[model samples]
Target: MLGDGSLGNVGSPPRVGCVAGVFDLFHVGHVDVLERARRHSDRLVVAVLSDEWAMDAWGARPFVPLLERAQIVEHLRCVDEVVAVDDVRPEWLTGVLGVQTVFAASATDGVLGVDELDGIPPGLITVLPAGRGSRSPILRAAIDQRQSRSSVA
Candidate 1:
Protein backbone atom coordinates (compact mmCIF):
# COMPACT_ATOMS: atom_id res chain seq x y z
CA MET A 1 0.00 0.00 0.00
CA LEU A 2 1.10 3.51 -0.69
CA GLY A 3 1.19 6.26 1.89
CA ASP A 4 -2.46 6.85 1.14
CA GLY A 5 -3.38 3.36 2.43
CA SER A 6 -4.07 2.21 -1.12
CA LEU A 7 -2.32 1.69 -4.40
CA GLY A 8 -0.57 4.77 -5.69
CA ASN A 9 -2.92 6.78 -7.85
CA VAL A 10 -1.65 10.32 -7.76
CA GLY A 11 -4.24 11.93 -10.02
CA SER A 12 -7.02 9.42 -10.10
CA PRO A 13 -10.61 10.47 -10.08
CA PRO A 14 -12.56 10.63 -6.86
CA ARG A 15 -14.81 7.77 -7.87
CA VAL A 16 -13.01 4.69 -9.12
CA GLY A 17 -14.87 1.47 -9.91
CA CYS A 18 -13.41 -2.00 -10.32
CA VAL A 19 -14.55 -5.00 -12.35
CA ALA A 20 -12.91 -8.38 -12.04
CA GLY A 21 -13.35 -11.30 -14.45
CA VAL A 22 -11.65 -13.99 -16.45
CA PHE A 23 -12.37 -12.15 -19.71
CA ASP A 24 -10.98 -15.06 -21.66
CA LEU A 25 -12.81 -14.80 -24.93
CA PHE A 26 -13.33 -11.03 -24.95
CA HIS A 27 -16.96 -11.35 -25.98
CA VAL A 28 -19.73 -8.79 -26.43
CA GLY A 29 -21.02 -9.40 -22.94
CA HIS A 30 -17.69 -8.35 -21.52
CA VAL A 31 -17.89 -5.07 -23.41
CA ASP A 32 -21.40 -4.42 -22.18
CA VAL A 33 -20.41 -4.83 -18.54
CA LEU A 34 -17.35 -2.62 -18.89
CA GLU A 35 -19.33 0.09 -20.63
CA ARG A 36 -21.95 -0.05 -17.92
CA ALA A 37 -19.33 -0.02 -15.22
CA ARG A 38 -17.71 3.07 -16.69
CA ARG A 39 -20.96 4.98 -16.39
CA HIS A 40 -20.99 4.63 -12.61
CA SER A 41 -17.49 5.90 -11.95
CA ASP A 42 -15.05 8.49 -13.23
CA ARG A 43 -12.42 5.83 -13.83
CA LEU A 44 -12.80 2.08 -14.28
CA VAL A 45 -10.18 -0.47 -13.36
CA VAL A 46 -10.55 -3.94 -14.82
CA ALA A 47 -8.90 -6.87 -13.10
CA VAL A 48 -8.28 -9.71 -15.50
CA LEU A 49 -7.98 -13.06 -13.77
CA SER A 50 -4.55 -14.61 -14.11
CA ASP A 51 -4.27 -17.98 -15.86
CA GLU A 52 -3.48 -19.67 -12.57
CA TRP A 53 -6.45 -18.05 -10.89
CA ALA A 54 -8.71 -19.00 -13.76
CA MET A 55 -7.67 -22.62 -13.55
CA ASP A 56 -8.05 -22.69 -9.80
CA ALA A 57 -11.42 -20.97 -9.77
CA TRP A 58 -13.06 -22.37 -12.90
CA GLY A 59 -11.08 -25.59 -13.22
CA ALA A 60 -9.94 -24.74 -16.72
CA ARG A 61 -7.21 -22.64 -18.27
CA PRO A 62 -8.26 -19.63 -20.28
CA PHE A 63 -8.08 -19.95 -24.02
CA VAL A 64 -6.48 -16.53 -24.13
CA PRO A 65 -3.40 -16.19 -21.96
CA LEU A 66 -3.13 -13.60 -19.20
CA LEU A 67 -0.99 -11.10 -21.14
CA GLU A 68 -3.17 -11.36 -24.25
CA ARG A 69 -6.37 -11.02 -22.31
CA ALA A 70 -5.01 -8.08 -20.35
CA GLN A 71 -3.90 -6.50 -23.62
CA ILE A 72 -7.35 -6.90 -25.10
CA VAL A 73 -9.02 -5.42 -22.02
CA GLU A 74 -6.41 -2.68 -21.79
CA HIS A 75 -7.39 -1.35 -25.23
CA LEU A 76 -11.10 -1.12 -24.50
CA ARG A 77 -12.33 2.46 -24.31
CA CYS A 78 -14.45 1.81 -21.24
CA VAL A 79 -11.51 0.55 -19.20
CA ASP A 80 -9.01 2.98 -17.71
CA GLU A 81 -6.53 0.48 -16.23
CA VAL A 82 -6.09 -3.24 -16.72
CA VAL A 83 -4.43 -5.27 -13.98
CA ALA A 84 -3.91 -9.00 -13.69
CA VAL A 85 -5.12 -10.42 -10.38
CA ASP A 86 -4.80 -13.79 -8.74
CA ASP A 87 -7.94 -13.29 -6.69
CA VAL A 88 -10.78 -10.90 -6.04
CA ARG A 89 -11.00 -9.56 -2.55
CA PRO A 90 -13.37 -6.79 -1.58
CA GLU A 91 -11.06 -5.46 1.15
CA TRP A 92 -8.16 -5.29 -1.28
CA LEU A 93 -10.22 -3.41 -3.83
CA THR A 94 -11.56 -0.91 -1.37
CA GLY A 95 -8.74 -0.71 1.15
CA VAL A 96 -5.74 -1.22 -1.10
CA LEU A 97 -6.89 0.05 -4.50
CA GLY A 98 -8.93 3.06 -3.46
CA VAL A 99 -11.91 1.67 -5.29
CA GLN A 100 -15.17 3.30 -4.30
CA THR A 101 -17.36 0.80 -6.09
CA VAL A 102 -17.04 -2.78 -7.27
CA PHE A 103 -19.12 -3.64 -10.30
CA ALA A 104 -20.19 -7.21 -10.74
CA ALA A 105 -21.84 -8.89 -13.70
CA SER A 106 -24.48 -10.61 -11.61
CA ALA A 107 -25.32 -11.39 -8.02
CA THR A 108 -26.21 -15.05 -8.40
CA ASP A 109 -24.18 -16.03 -11.44
CA GLY A 110 -20.93 -16.48 -9.52
CA VAL A 111 -19.14 -13.46 -10.90
CA LEU A 112 -19.32 -11.66 -7.58
CA GLY A 113 -22.00 -12.96 -5.32
CA VAL A 114 -23.49 -10.92 -2.56
CA ASP A 115 -21.69 -13.07 -0.03
CA GLU A 116 -18.39 -12.27 -1.63
CA LEU A 117 -18.81 -8.54 -1.09
CA ASP A 118 -18.34 -8.88 2.62
CA GLY A 119 -15.91 -6.04 3.16
CA ILE A 120 -17.46 -3.57 0.76
CA PRO A 121 -20.54 -1.71 1.74
CA PRO A 122 -23.82 -2.80 0.16
CA GLY A 123 -24.30 0.54 -1.55
CA LEU A 124 -20.84 0.34 -3.07
CA ILE A 125 -21.44 -3.05 -4.65
CA THR A 126 -23.28 -2.69 -7.92
CA VAL A 127 -24.65 -5.87 -9.46
CA LEU A 128 -25.31 -5.07 -13.05
CA PRO A 129 -27.82 -7.05 -15.05
CA ALA A 130 -26.59 -10.08 -16.88
CA GLY A 131 -25.46 -9.59 -20.46
CA ARG A 132 -26.97 -11.24 -23.54
CA GLY A 133 -24.73 -14.33 -23.64
CA SER A 134 -21.47 -15.77 -22.42
CA ARG A 135 -18.45 -17.13 -24.31
CA SER A 136 -17.81 -20.42 -22.53
CA PRO A 137 -20.79 -22.39 -23.75
CA ILE A 138 -20.67 -20.85 -27.20
CA LEU A 139 -16.98 -21.56 -27.60
CA ARG A 140 -17.38 -25.08 -26.28
CA ALA A 141 -20.10 -25.83 -28.83
CA ALA A 142 -18.00 -24.44 -31.64
CA ILE A 143 -15.06 -26.55 -30.63
CA ASP A 144 -17.21 -29.65 -30.30
CA GLN A 145 -18.66 -29.09 -33.75
CA ARG A 146 -15.23 -28.70 -35.27
CA GLN A 147 -13.98 -31.85 -33.59
CA SER A 148 -16.97 -33.82 -34.82
CA ARG A 149 -16.46 -32.61 -38.36
CA SER A 150 -12.81 -33.57 -38.28
CA SER A 151 -13.60 -37.01 -36.88
CA VAL A 152 -16.24 -37.59 -39.56
CA ALA A 153 -13.90 -36.53 -42.33
Candidate 2:
Protein backbone atom coordinates (compact mmCIF):
# COMPACT_ATOMS: atom_id res chain seq x y z
CA MET A 1 0.00 0.00 0.00
CA LEU A 2 1.35 3.45 -0.90
CA GLY A 3 -0.19 4.99 2.22
CA ASP A 4 2.47 3.25 4.27
CA GLY A 5 5.08 4.40 1.78
CA SER A 6 5.93 0.82 0.80
CA LEU A 7 5.74 -0.45 -2.76
CA GLY A 8 5.98 -4.15 -1.85
CA ASN A 9 4.23 -6.60 -4.10
CA VAL A 10 0.81 -7.77 -2.87
CA GLY A 11 1.39 -11.20 -4.47
CA SER A 12 -0.39 -12.23 -7.66
CA PRO A 13 -4.15 -12.61 -7.42
CA PRO A 14 -6.35 -14.82 -9.59
CA ARG A 15 -6.57 -11.77 -11.80
CA VAL A 16 -4.69 -8.47 -11.47
CA GLY A 17 -6.62 -5.43 -12.61
CA CYS A 18 -5.41 -1.85 -13.04
CA VAL A 19 -6.97 1.63 -13.22
CA ALA A 20 -4.83 4.67 -13.97
CA GLY A 21 -5.86 8.29 -13.48
CA VAL A 22 -4.89 11.72 -12.20
CA PHE A 23 -7.40 11.49 -9.36
CA ASP A 24 -6.96 15.21 -8.84
CA LEU A 25 -10.15 15.81 -6.93
CA PHE A 26 -11.37 12.57 -5.43
CA HIS A 27 -15.10 12.12 -5.85
CA VAL A 28 -17.89 9.55 -5.92
CA GLY A 29 -17.15 8.76 -9.54
CA HIS A 30 -13.61 7.77 -8.57
CA VAL A 31 -14.96 5.44 -5.89
CA ASP A 32 -17.48 4.02 -8.36
CA VAL A 33 -14.76 3.09 -10.85
CA LEU A 34 -12.40 1.66 -8.25
CA GLU A 35 -15.02 -0.49 -6.59
CA ARG A 36 -16.36 -1.67 -9.93
CA ALA A 37 -12.86 -2.51 -11.12
CA ARG A 38 -12.19 -4.49 -7.96
CA ARG A 39 -15.24 -6.62 -8.71
CA HIS A 40 -13.67 -7.71 -11.99
CA SER A 41 -10.48 -8.99 -10.35
CA ASP A 42 -9.26 -10.36 -7.07
CA ARG A 43 -6.92 -7.43 -6.60
CA LEU A 44 -6.87 -3.90 -7.92
CA VAL A 45 -3.88 -1.68 -8.60
CA VAL A 46 -4.49 2.04 -9.05
CA ALA A 47 -1.97 4.13 -10.91
CA VAL A 48 -1.94 7.76 -9.77
CA LEU A 49 -0.63 9.93 -12.53
CA SER A 50 2.43 12.00 -11.67
CA ASP A 51 2.09 15.77 -11.37
CA GLU A 52 4.15 16.29 -14.48
CA TRP A 53 1.97 13.99 -16.56
CA ALA A 54 -1.21 15.63 -15.30
CA MET A 55 0.10 19.11 -16.08
CA ASP A 56 1.38 18.12 -19.51
CA ALA A 57 -1.71 16.17 -20.47
CA TRP A 58 -4.36 18.54 -19.17
CA GLY A 59 -2.45 21.81 -19.48
CA ALA A 60 -3.45 22.40 -15.86
CA ARG A 61 -1.77 21.17 -12.73
CA PRO A 62 -3.78 18.91 -10.47
CA PHE A 63 -5.47 20.67 -7.56
CA VAL A 64 -4.14 17.88 -5.39
CA PRO A 65 -0.48 16.91 -5.45
CA LEU A 66 0.64 13.53 -6.82
CA LEU A 67 1.76 11.90 -3.58
CA GLU A 68 -1.30 13.21 -1.79
CA ARG A 69 -3.57 11.86 -4.51
CA ALA A 70 -1.76 8.52 -4.35
CA GLN A 71 -2.12 8.37 -0.58
CA ILE A 72 -5.83 9.09 -0.87
CA VAL A 73 -6.23 6.26 -3.38
CA GLU A 74 -4.08 3.87 -1.33
CA HIS A 75 -6.47 4.22 1.56
CA LEU A 76 -9.40 3.05 -0.54
CA ARG A 77 -10.71 -0.41 0.39
CA CYS A 78 -11.11 -1.42 -3.23
CA VAL A 79 -7.48 -0.75 -4.07
CA ASP A 80 -4.85 -3.27 -3.03
CA GLU A 81 -2.00 -1.12 -4.21
CA VAL A 82 -1.34 2.40 -5.47
CA VAL A 83 1.52 3.31 -7.78
CA ALA A 84 2.76 6.54 -9.28
CA VAL A 85 2.71 6.37 -13.05
CA ASP A 86 4.26 8.86 -15.45
CA ASP A 87 2.87 7.09 -18.48
CA VAL A 88 -0.34 5.20 -19.21
CA ARG A 89 1.08 3.05 -21.98
CA PRO A 90 -0.20 -0.51 -22.05
CA GLU A 91 3.32 -1.90 -22.17
CA TRP A 92 4.22 -0.09 -18.96
CA LEU A 93 1.09 -1.27 -17.14
CA THR A 94 1.36 -4.87 -18.41
CA GLY A 95 5.14 -5.35 -18.72
CA VAL A 96 6.05 -3.50 -15.56
CA LEU A 97 3.04 -3.82 -13.28
CA GLY A 98 1.88 -7.24 -14.52
CA VAL A 99 -1.68 -6.00 -15.01
CA GLN A 100 -3.96 -8.64 -16.54
CA THR A 101 -6.95 -6.38 -17.13
CA VAL A 102 -7.21 -2.61 -17.39
CA PHE A 103 -10.38 -0.97 -16.13
CA ALA A 104 -11.32 2.41 -17.53
CA ALA A 105 -14.27 4.75 -17.29
CA SER A 106 -15.93 5.72 -20.56
CA ALA A 107 -15.07 9.05 -22.21
CA THR A 108 -17.70 11.07 -20.31
CA ASP A 109 -16.70 9.56 -17.00
CA GLY A 110 -13.02 9.03 -17.72
CA VAL A 111 -10.20 10.86 -16.03
CA LEU A 112 -7.75 9.24 -18.41
CA GLY A 113 -8.34 10.52 -21.92
CA VAL A 114 -8.95 8.19 -24.86
CA ASP A 115 -5.42 8.66 -26.16
CA GLU A 116 -4.14 6.73 -23.16
CA LEU A 117 -5.93 3.61 -24.37
CA ASP A 118 -3.84 3.43 -27.50
CA GLY A 119 -1.92 0.15 -28.06
CA ILE A 120 -3.85 -1.75 -25.39
CA PRO A 121 -5.84 -4.73 -26.64
CA PRO A 122 -9.60 -4.20 -26.71
CA GLY A 123 -10.18 -7.52 -24.95
CA LEU A 124 -7.81 -6.56 -22.14
CA ILE A 125 -9.71 -3.38 -21.38
CA THR A 126 -12.99 -3.04 -19.52
CA VAL A 127 -14.89 0.19 -20.11
CA LEU A 128 -17.21 1.06 -17.30
CA PRO A 129 -20.38 2.90 -18.29
CA ALA A 130 -21.17 6.46 -17.27
CA GLY A 131 -22.87 5.77 -14.01
CA ARG A 132 -24.90 7.91 -11.61
CA GLY A 133 -21.61 9.07 -10.19
CA SER A 134 -20.19 10.44 -13.38
CA ARG A 135 -16.75 12.02 -13.71
CA SER A 136 -17.44 15.77 -13.86
CA PRO A 137 -14.08 17.30 -13.21
CA ILE A 138 -14.68 19.72 -16.03
CA LEU A 139 -17.81 20.92 -14.35
CA ARG A 140 -16.00 21.23 -11.05
CA ALA A 141 -13.27 23.21 -12.72
CA ALA A 142 -15.76 25.55 -14.29
CA ILE A 143 -17.45 26.17 -10.95
CA ASP A 144 -14.12 26.89 -9.35
CA GLN A 145 -13.28 29.32 -12.12
CA ARG A 146 -16.58 31.12 -11.70
CA GLN A 147 -16.17 31.32 -7.95
CA SER A 148 -12.66 32.65 -8.29
CA ARG A 149 -13.79 35.30 -10.75
CA SER A 150 -16.64 36.38 -8.49
CA SER A 151 -14.28 36.59 -5.56
CA VAL A 152 -11.87 38.78 -7.53
CA ALA A 153 -14.69 40.97 -8.77
Candidate 3:
Protein backbone atom coordinates (compact mmCIF):
# COMPACT_ATOMS: atom_id res chain seq x y z
CA MET A 1 0.00 0.00 0.00
CA LEU A 2 1.34 3.44 -0.89
CA GLY A 3 -0.84 5.55 1.39
CA ASP A 4 -4.56 5.74 0.49
CA GLY A 5 -5.30 1.99 1.11
CA SER A 6 -4.67 0.09 -2.17
CA LEU A 7 -2.88 -3.23 -1.95
CA GLY A 8 -0.45 -4.56 -4.56
CA ASN A 9 -0.86 -8.07 -5.96
CA VAL A 10 0.61 -10.35 -8.64
CA GLY A 11 -1.94 -13.08 -9.11
CA SER A 12 -5.61 -13.43 -8.09
CA PRO A 13 -8.32 -10.85 -8.85
CA PRO A 14 -6.75 -7.47 -8.53
CA ARG A 15 -8.82 -5.03 -6.54
CA VAL A 16 -8.40 -2.46 -9.26
CA GLY A 17 -8.78 1.26 -8.65
CA CYS A 18 -8.77 4.26 -11.01
CA VAL A 19 -7.75 7.91 -11.05
CA ALA A 20 -8.13 10.30 -13.98
CA GLY A 21 -6.38 13.57 -14.63
CA VAL A 22 -4.93 15.79 -17.30
CA PHE A 23 -1.62 15.73 -15.39
CA ASP A 24 -0.64 18.83 -17.35
CA LEU A 25 2.45 19.83 -15.46
CA PHE A 26 3.12 16.62 -13.53
CA HIS A 27 3.87 18.30 -10.25
CA VAL A 28 4.19 17.00 -6.70
CA GLY A 29 0.43 17.21 -6.23
CA HIS A 30 -0.07 14.80 -9.10
CA VAL A 31 2.40 12.44 -7.48
CA ASP A 32 0.57 12.61 -4.16
CA VAL A 33 -2.77 11.87 -5.81
CA LEU A 34 -1.42 8.83 -7.69
CA GLU A 35 0.41 7.49 -4.66
CA ARG A 36 -2.73 7.84 -2.59
CA ALA A 37 -4.86 6.07 -5.19
CA ARG A 38 -2.40 3.18 -5.22
CA ARG A 39 -2.99 2.62 -1.52
CA HIS A 40 -6.75 2.12 -1.91
CA SER A 41 -6.81 -0.99 -4.09
CA ASP A 42 -4.71 -3.95 -5.22
CA ARG A 43 -3.95 -2.21 -8.47
CA LEU A 44 -4.05 1.45 -9.43
CA VAL A 45 -4.99 2.36 -13.00
CA VAL A 46 -4.24 5.92 -14.04
CA ALA A 47 -6.09 7.60 -16.89
CA VAL A 48 -4.31 10.51 -18.46
CA LEU A 49 -6.58 12.69 -20.54
CA SER A 50 -5.70 13.08 -24.20
CA ASP A 51 -4.41 16.42 -25.42
CA GLU A 52 -7.54 17.08 -27.42
CA TRP A 53 -9.79 16.19 -24.52
CA ALA A 54 -7.78 18.34 -22.15
CA MET A 55 -7.77 21.30 -24.50
CA ASP A 56 -11.51 21.00 -24.94
CA ALA A 57 -12.01 21.08 -21.20
CA TRP A 58 -9.20 23.36 -20.07
CA GLY A 59 -8.30 25.43 -23.14
CA ALA A 60 -4.58 24.90 -23.70
CA ARG A 61 -1.92 22.37 -24.55
CA PRO A 62 -0.37 20.70 -21.54
CA PHE A 63 3.16 21.59 -20.52
CA VAL A 64 4.20 18.00 -21.23
CA PRO A 65 3.18 15.89 -24.22
CA LEU A 66 0.48 13.24 -23.69
CA LEU A 67 2.79 10.29 -24.31
CA GLU A 68 5.44 11.72 -22.03
CA ARG A 69 2.91 12.28 -19.27
CA ALA A 70 1.57 8.74 -19.59
CA GLN A 71 5.05 7.31 -19.55
CA ILE A 72 5.94 9.28 -16.44
CA VAL A 73 2.94 7.87 -14.62
CA GLU A 74 3.52 4.36 -15.94
CA HIS A 75 6.99 4.33 -14.48
CA LEU A 76 5.79 5.05 -10.98
CA ARG A 77 5.95 2.04 -8.67
CA CYS A 78 2.47 2.73 -7.29
CA VAL A 79 0.73 2.78 -10.67
CA ASP A 80 -0.30 -0.58 -12.14
CA GLU A 81 -1.78 0.58 -15.43
CA VAL A 82 -1.66 3.79 -17.44
CA VAL A 83 -4.22 4.51 -20.12
CA ALA A 84 -5.47 7.44 -22.18
CA VAL A 85 -8.87 9.00 -21.51
CA ASP A 86 -10.18 10.49 -24.72
CA ASP A 87 -13.73 11.02 -23.51
CA VAL A 88 -15.31 13.39 -21.03
CA ARG A 89 -17.08 10.92 -18.81
CA PRO A 90 -14.77 9.54 -16.16
CA GLU A 91 -17.48 7.19 -14.88
CA TRP A 92 -17.02 5.22 -18.07
CA LEU A 93 -13.45 4.69 -16.98
CA THR A 94 -14.47 2.70 -13.93
CA GLY A 95 -16.42 0.37 -16.15
CA VAL A 96 -13.61 -0.04 -18.66
CA LEU A 97 -10.99 -0.77 -16.04
CA GLY A 98 -13.23 -2.99 -13.87
CA VAL A 99 -12.17 -0.80 -11.03
CA GLN A 100 -13.41 -1.10 -7.49
CA THR A 101 -12.96 2.58 -6.82
CA VAL A 102 -12.22 5.80 -8.72
CA PHE A 103 -10.03 8.49 -7.22
CA ALA A 104 -9.91 12.21 -7.98
CA ALA A 105 -8.85 15.44 -6.39
CA SER A 106 -11.45 16.59 -3.90
CA ALA A 107 -10.89 20.10 -5.14
CA THR A 108 -12.37 19.04 -8.48
CA ASP A 109 -15.78 19.32 -6.75
CA GLY A 110 -17.32 16.36 -8.57
CA VAL A 111 -17.72 18.72 -11.50
CA LEU A 112 -16.66 16.41 -14.31
CA GLY A 113 -20.05 17.26 -15.96
CA VAL A 114 -21.04 13.62 -16.01
CA ASP A 115 -24.50 13.21 -14.53
CA GLU A 116 -24.67 11.62 -11.10
CA LEU A 117 -22.49 8.51 -11.13
CA ASP A 118 -24.80 6.64 -8.77
CA GLY A 119 -25.95 4.11 -11.40
CA ILE A 120 -22.57 3.30 -12.87
CA PRO A 121 -21.26 -0.24 -12.69
CA PRO A 122 -18.01 -0.92 -10.78
CA GLY A 123 -19.42 1.71 -8.50
CA LEU A 124 -17.15 3.37 -6.00
CA ILE A 125 -15.73 6.87 -6.05
CA THR A 126 -13.28 8.52 -3.69
CA VAL A 127 -11.98 12.06 -3.77
CA LEU A 128 -8.71 12.78 -2.05
CA PRO A 129 -7.99 16.31 -0.84
CA ALA A 130 -5.25 18.14 -2.65
CA GLY A 131 -1.89 17.98 -0.93
CA ARG A 132 -0.65 21.13 0.79
CA GLY A 133 0.23 23.84 -1.71
CA SER A 134 -0.12 21.36 -4.55
CA ARG A 135 -2.68 22.70 -6.98
CA SER A 136 -2.84 23.80 -10.58
CA PRO A 137 -3.75 27.35 -9.70
CA ILE A 138 -0.72 27.70 -7.48
CA LEU A 139 1.55 26.18 -10.06
CA ARG A 140 0.18 28.31 -12.83
CA ALA A 141 0.56 31.46 -10.80
CA ALA A 142 4.13 30.58 -9.99
CA ILE A 143 4.90 30.05 -13.61
CA ASP A 144 3.34 33.32 -14.63
CA GLN A 145 5.17 35.23 -11.89
CA ARG A 146 8.48 33.66 -12.82
CA GLN A 147 7.95 34.52 -16.46
CA SER A 148 7.08 38.09 -15.59
CA ARG A 149 10.20 38.49 -13.47
CA SER A 150 12.44 36.98 -16.13
CA SER A 151 10.95 39.22 -18.79
CA VAL A 152 11.44 42.29 -16.61
CA ALA A 153 15.07 41.35 -15.87
Candidate 4:
Protein backbone atom coordinates (compact mmCIF):
# COMPACT_ATOMS: atom_id res chain seq x y z
CA MET A 1 0.00 0.00 0.00
CA LEU A 2 1.26 3.41 -1.01
CA GLY A 3 0.24 6.61 0.73
CA ASP A 4 -3.01 5.73 2.59
CA GLY A 5 -3.59 2.44 0.75
CA SER A 6 -4.75 -0.51 2.82
CA LEU A 7 -5.03 -4.28 2.41
CA GLY A 8 -8.45 -5.70 3.26
CA ASN A 9 -9.18 -9.13 4.67
CA VAL A 10 -12.29 -11.27 4.41
CA GLY A 11 -13.34 -10.62 8.01
CA SER A 12 -14.52 -7.46 9.64
CA PRO A 13 -11.63 -5.20 10.60
CA PRO A 14 -11.44 -4.29 14.24
CA ARG A 15 -9.65 -1.56 16.22
CA VAL A 16 -6.94 0.20 14.23
CA GLY A 17 -3.32 -0.08 15.38
CA CYS A 18 -0.31 1.50 13.63
CA VAL A 19 3.36 0.49 13.61
CA ALA A 20 6.11 2.10 11.57
CA GLY A 21 9.62 0.95 10.73
CA VAL A 22 12.23 0.85 8.04
CA PHE A 23 11.82 -2.92 7.68
CA ASP A 24 14.85 -2.97 5.42
CA LEU A 25 16.06 -6.49 5.94
CA PHE A 26 12.67 -7.73 7.21
CA HIS A 27 14.32 -9.81 9.94
CA VAL A 28 12.93 -11.62 12.98
CA GLY A 29 12.88 -8.46 15.05
CA HIS A 30 10.45 -6.90 12.61
CA VAL A 31 8.31 -10.02 12.80
CA ASP A 32 8.30 -9.95 16.59
CA VAL A 33 7.17 -6.34 16.81
CA LEU A 34 4.48 -6.83 14.17
CA GLU A 35 3.17 -9.96 15.85
CA ARG A 36 2.93 -8.19 19.20
CA ALA A 37 1.16 -5.27 17.58
CA ARG A 38 -1.44 -7.56 16.02
CA ARG A 39 -2.13 -9.12 19.39
CA HIS A 40 -3.03 -5.67 20.69
CA SER A 41 -5.33 -4.67 17.81
CA ASP A 42 -7.59 -6.53 15.45
CA ARG A 43 -6.44 -4.50 12.49
CA LEU A 44 -2.70 -3.87 12.30
CA VAL A 45 -1.53 -1.12 9.97
CA VAL A 46 2.18 -0.93 9.18
CA ALA A 47 4.08 2.01 7.78
CA VAL A 48 7.35 1.36 5.95
CA LEU A 49 9.86 4.14 5.56
CA SER A 50 10.87 5.15 2.03
CA ASP A 51 14.47 4.58 0.97
CA GLU A 52 15.16 8.29 0.65
CA TRP A 53 13.67 9.07 4.03
CA ALA A 54 15.46 6.09 5.50
CA MET A 55 18.79 7.47 4.31
CA ASP A 56 18.02 10.86 5.82
CA ALA A 57 16.81 9.46 9.12
CA TRP A 58 19.02 6.43 9.62
CA GLY A 59 21.93 7.52 7.41
CA ALA A 60 21.70 4.36 5.31
CA ARG A 61 19.60 3.31 2.34
CA PRO A 62 17.46 0.24 2.74
CA PHE A 63 18.70 -2.95 1.09
CA VAL A 64 15.11 -3.50 0.00
CA PRO A 65 13.39 -0.67 -1.83
CA LEU A 66 10.24 1.03 -0.56
CA LEU A 67 7.69 -0.54 -2.92
CA GLU A 68 9.21 -3.96 -2.52
CA ARG A 69 9.35 -3.53 1.23
CA ALA A 70 5.71 -2.50 1.24
CA GLN A 71 4.82 -5.60 -0.74
CA ILE A 72 6.77 -7.80 1.64
CA VAL A 73 5.10 -6.28 4.67
CA GLU A 74 1.68 -6.53 3.05
CA HIS A 75 2.09 -10.26 2.82
CA LEU A 76 2.80 -10.65 6.51
CA ARG A 77 0.13 -12.50 8.51
CA CYS A 78 0.23 -9.86 11.26
CA VAL A 79 -0.35 -6.91 8.97
CA ASP A 80 -3.82 -5.84 7.89
CA GLU A 81 -2.46 -2.96 5.86
CA VAL A 82 0.91 -1.58 4.73
CA VAL A 83 1.58 2.06 4.00
CA ALA A 84 4.66 3.45 2.25
CA VAL A 85 5.44 6.68 4.03
CA ASP A 86 8.23 9.21 3.69
CA ASP A 87 8.88 9.80 7.37
CA VAL A 88 7.99 8.34 10.75
CA ARG A 89 5.30 10.85 11.65
CA PRO A 90 3.48 8.74 14.18
CA GLU A 91 1.00 11.46 15.19
CA TRP A 92 0.00 12.15 11.60
CA LEU A 93 -0.14 8.43 10.90
CA THR A 94 -2.36 7.85 13.90
CA GLY A 95 -4.68 10.64 12.83
CA VAL A 96 -4.73 9.59 9.18
CA LEU A 97 -5.46 5.95 9.87
CA GLY A 98 -7.58 6.47 12.99
CA VAL A 99 -5.08 4.39 14.90
CA GLN A 100 -6.10 3.64 18.47
CA THR A 101 -2.67 2.58 19.57
CA VAL A 102 0.80 3.17 18.13
CA PHE A 103 3.15 0.26 18.73
CA ALA A 104 6.82 1.05 19.07
CA ALA A 105 9.69 -1.45 19.30
CA SER A 106 12.49 1.08 19.67
CA ALA A 107 14.02 2.47 22.83
CA THR A 108 12.56 5.75 24.04
CA ASP A 109 15.95 7.47 24.15
CA GLY A 110 16.80 6.21 20.67
CA VAL A 111 14.39 6.02 17.71
CA LEU A 112 10.94 6.39 19.20
CA GLY A 113 11.92 9.32 21.38
CA VAL A 114 9.50 11.82 22.89
CA ASP A 115 10.14 14.28 20.07
CA GLU A 116 8.76 11.93 17.36
CA LEU A 117 5.56 11.34 19.33
CA ASP A 118 4.56 14.88 20.11
CA GLY A 119 0.91 15.09 19.01
CA ILE A 120 -0.25 11.57 19.87
CA PRO A 121 -2.61 11.28 22.83
CA PRO A 122 -1.23 10.07 26.13
CA GLY A 123 -1.31 6.36 26.82
CA LEU A 124 -1.97 5.74 23.12
CA ILE A 125 1.60 4.71 22.43
CA THR A 126 2.65 1.27 23.59
CA VAL A 127 6.38 0.59 23.81
CA LEU A 128 6.85 -3.05 23.00
CA PRO A 129 9.89 -5.07 24.06
CA ALA A 130 12.81 -5.37 21.65
CA GLY A 131 13.09 -8.62 19.75
CA ARG A 132 16.20 -10.60 20.66
CA GLY A 133 17.64 -7.35 21.95
CA SER A 134 18.07 -6.22 18.35
CA ARG A 135 17.03 -3.01 16.62
CA SER A 136 17.70 -1.46 13.19
CA PRO A 137 21.09 -0.08 14.16
CA ILE A 138 22.30 -3.40 15.49
CA LEU A 139 20.95 -5.30 12.53
CA ARG A 140 22.45 -2.84 10.07
CA ALA A 141 25.82 -3.08 11.75
CA ALA A 142 25.74 -6.85 11.49
CA ILE A 143 24.80 -6.73 7.84
CA ASP A 144 27.51 -4.18 7.14
CA GLN A 145 30.10 -6.31 8.82
CA ARG A 146 29.10 -9.33 6.78
CA GLN A 147 29.20 -7.37 3.54
CA SER A 148 32.61 -5.95 4.38
CA ARG A 149 34.00 -9.38 5.22
CA SER A 150 32.63 -10.85 2.02
CA SER A 151 34.15 -8.02 0.02
CA VAL A 152 37.50 -8.49 1.71
CA ALA A 153 37.70 -12.24 1.10
Model number with the top lDDT: 2
Candidate 3 local lDDT, 1-153, one digit each (tens): 333443344455767877777777766767777776677777888878789976876686777899998998899998888988776354565556777777656543322212323344434666666554356777777887998899999
TM-scores for all candidates? Answer: 0.75, 0.78, 0.71, 0.71
RMSD of model 4 against the true structure: 6.6
**Candidate 4: clashing residue pairs, number:** 0
Q: How close to the true structure is residue 79 of candidate 1, measured as C-alpha lDDT?
A: 78
Q: Which stretches of candidate 1 lie over 4 Å from their true place?
A: 1-13, 107-123, 134-136, 144-153
Worst 10 residues of 3 by lDDT: 109-118
| Best-first order by TM-score | 2, 1, 4, 3
Per-residue lDDT, model 1, residue 5, is: 34
Q: Residue by residue across 1-153, what tens digits does model 2's lDDT show?
A: 422323334762457789888887788778877887777777689988898987787787787898899999999987889999887777787888888888778645445534576677887787776654654667777878998999999
Model 4, range 66-136, lDDT digits (tens) per residue?
Answer: 88889988999878888888775645766688787887666421224334555656678887775554456
Top TM-score hit = 2
**In candidate 2, which residue ranges exceed 4 Å CA deviation?**
1-13, 107-110, 113-115, 134-139, 142-153
Q: What is the lDDT of candidate 3?
A: 0.67
RMSD of each: 6.5, 5.9, 5.0, 6.6
TM-score of 2: 0.78
TM-score of model number 4: 0.71
